[model samples]
Target: MKNILIVGGSKGIGNAILLQQLEQNKVYNISRNAPEVTHDNLVHFSLNVLEDALPEIESIDTIIYCPGSINLKPINSLSIDDFRNDFEINVIGAVKVIQKYLATLKKGTNPSIVLFSTVAAKLGMPFHASIATAKAGVEGLVKSLGAELASAVRINAIAPTITDTTLAAGILRNDRMKENMVERHPMKGYLQATEVAGMADFLISDKAKSISGQVFEMDYGIVSFKI
Candidate 1:
């Protein structure tokens, strides 16, 4: 079984990935809060990726950085700190985790890394300036690191459209809003955490051994089609 380290695996898409991997791999979760479920193959580390020092693990085959922000607001209403905070959460934190575990990862079997972006980075949505800028940085990191770590390791990112998670609770808070969101997508639906989790699972597996430095958009056609 692979040894996987998932930063911010306490909730939402992260938690879904954590649960899915528990049956097959040993998972190390680092987040501010503990995950609600307990499993023999699971271990928890309580710390902030940006504020606290990450714990040491002897070996790790995959690193999945799941911390992100969705601070949507008009440019006039957004502050510099808003951009800073979002960048730190969406990009810097992933950098910190990857740097900390690079050595151990290099030594592991079929080592790979996965980071998250958002469709907002490419879709040009209103009120998404801060997050779009930040997730754009994430995409850059994936491309650069995919080349830098070419032989030693592999890296990629997932860019999902508005997922039904607490992070997006503000947007999908009402039935009317939810319907609007569904209608916005050509697929007529938004994403479930499980579907994103499945993509994460594929990126880190031997099945994706040939893939790296790419951003997979789970956008439900929002970014891919006009219909």
Candidate 2:
């Protein structure tokens, strides 16, 4: 069975991907807090991606970095630590995972690495300067690593906008905010957590062998046809 490690898989999109893949692979979810999933193939560990490099790594088949923080603020109001923290979690976190699992990945038949970014990293949006800027760094990190890890491991990222995760509580909590977000997309709805899991599965599967060093926007057409 393929062995996969997911950093920050206790909640949001990460948990969905971990659960979806459990049917076929041995899944290890690294999180500081306990997750609410149980299965023979699923192993949950208390891990801090920011303070740790990855744990219990074996011949890793695929690894996904899911630690991200959203700090939305205007340029003038943004603090130095805000930018630093964003990079620490979103950019540095991915690097730590790759470095820790690089050797193990090389031992796999065809290893894959996935990171999460934001649609704001590609498309422009207001009040997204801080998180957007950090996720933009994430976009660059994946591409560069993809090239360096080729043949053995493939690196890719998923950038989504306005998904229905707890991370989007502020935006989806109120009627005005919800309606405003829906109106921006032609589909008039947000991308679901499962939709992203499907994308992640594709990226790590044989069908995506030719895909790497790119950010896939599963944004409900947020980048296309700005109506």
Candidate 3:
């Protein structure tokens, strides 16, 4: 079984990926809080990716960085620190985890890395300036590192539209809000963590061995179509 390290795997899409991978692979989860479930193949690390030092693991075949921010606000209401905090969470944290585990990852079987982005980075949406800018940086990193790590390791990013998670609780707080969100997407629905997790599973598996440095949009047609 492959040894997978998932940063911020305690909640939302990260937690969903953690649960699914445990059925087949050994999963190492690092997040501020512990996961709700446990299994023989699961390992949990409690710490902040930005404020705390990451734990060491000897073998890691796949690394999935899932920490992100949803700091939505009008440009006039946004502060410089808003941009800085979002960038640090969405981009710098991923960089830290990758750099820390680069050596061990290089020695593993079919080593690969996955990072999370957002459709806001591609679809021009109001009140998304901070997060969009940050996730955009993540896309750039995926492209550059996909080339730099070519032949040694593979890297990619997933850009999902508004997902049904606590991170988006503010937007989908009520039935009317939820209905509006569904109507906004051409698919007439938003994303579930499981669907995004499935994509993450594919991107890290041998099935996608030939893919790297790409951003797959799980936007449910929000970014892909006008209708």
- What is the lDDT for 227 in model 2? 69
Give the lowest summed-lDDT range of ten residues in model 2.
Answer: 50-59
For model 3, how does the per-residue alpha-carbon lDDT over 36-126 read when each residue is reduced to its tens digit?
9989999999999999989989999999999998888899999999999999998999999999999999999999999999999999999
Per-residue lDDT tens digits of candidate 1, residues 47-121?
888999889899899999999988878999999999999999998999999989999999999999999999988
Model 1 clash pairs are none
Q: What TM-score, computed on C-alpha atoms, does each candidate reach?
A: 0.99, 0.95, 0.98
- RMSD of model 1 against the true structure: 0.6
Scored by Cα lDDT, where does model 2 land? 0.85
Worst 10 residues of 3 by lDDT: 218-227
The lDDT of model 1 is 0.94
Residue-level lDDT for 67 in candidate 1? 95
lDDT of each: 0.94, 0.85, 0.95
Please write out the lDDT profile of model 2 over residues 59-122, one tens digit for every residue.
6889988888767778889998988999898998888777877888888867899999998988
